[model samples]
Target: MAALLEYLPLILFFAVYKFVDIYWATGVLIVTSSIQLGYHHFAHGKIATRHWIFFAIALVLGGLTILFQDEQFIKWKATVIYAVLAVSLIISRYIFKKNLVEKALIGVLKSANEKGDTDAPLNIELPKHICEQLNLMWVAILAFIAGLNIYIAYNFSLDFWVNFKVFGLMGITFVAILITMAKIYKYLPEDQS
Candidate 1:
């Protein structure tokens, strides 16, 4: 359900593209992304930084595509966004001495503990090596996605690119997420007997 909500804008964009045209789809995407961001902000009292970044990119790129009457801007939106994220993750991990993946996981565990959802007190500290590796993995994933989007945009038809953006990218991301979770499972604290 949460995942579906996360993809709502892209799904709507694909539907609008099929029903009408790229311009209309771009317009719908902008509106839907704004709404999604607003909903998250209102419901959670804060929005994820990544969601905010994506929303800004959607508005700017979608606006450019609509205003200039060129789909290329919108096509390059994913690549630019993903590249920015990849760079940011790398900088955070290396320059800032922060591991976003580990921080995010620890944040979730902290929230769960605050909500009394855990059977035992959760340890927020992760092994330094694990954090470094997780951050690198995320950076690699984002870079790969950025390259994949650009490759598809340049090589495929607009319709095919749209389908790949909405479905293929999501599928690949889901699998990557599963793999990441599996890789990190061994690092999780053991259940208290």
Candidate 2:
């Protein structure tokens, strides 16, 4: 349910774009994203940081697209979001000394353990350097995605870009998440417990 809600905006945007046009799609994106944000706030009592970032940018870029009667503004939204995420990851890892990937892995491990799951690995900590390497991998992945978006949006047709944005990028993102999880298994010591 939550996952569906999270993707509702993108799914609807793609459908609307297919039926009508970019301008209408941009409007739909903004409206649906705003609704998603509101749903998060209403249900959770607060919106997540990523939700805020996405909504704010989508609203601004979508607005620009409508106002200027140009699809280029909306085309850049995904790239901008990815760039912001990459920069934020770099800043958090360096300035704040926080590795979000490590934290996410730890949290998942913790939850699995707490659930009394036999498959859950022991709370063995990953080495700091290995964690840093993992974080850098994510940063690189995001930067690559951002660059890819720009390249495709400019070179390809808007319809192609829309399909890539909605389905292709989503597939890539899911694979990235799975890859991150796979890293924990690869780098961490086998839980002999």
> Clashing residue pairs in candidate 1, if any?
none
Q: RMSDs, each prediction?
A: 2.4, 2.8
Lowest-sum lDDT 10-residue window in model 2:
184-193
Q: Pick the candidate with the highest TM-score.
A: 1
For model 2, the local distance difference test gives: 0.87
Evaluate residue 157 in candidate 2 and report its C-alpha lDDT on the 0 to 100 scale.
95
Supply candidate 2's per-residue lDDT for 186.
Answer: 64
Reference-based TM-score of each model: 0.88, 0.88
Clashes of each: 0, 0
TM-score of 1: 0.88
- Each prediction's whole-model lDDT (CA): 0.86, 0.87
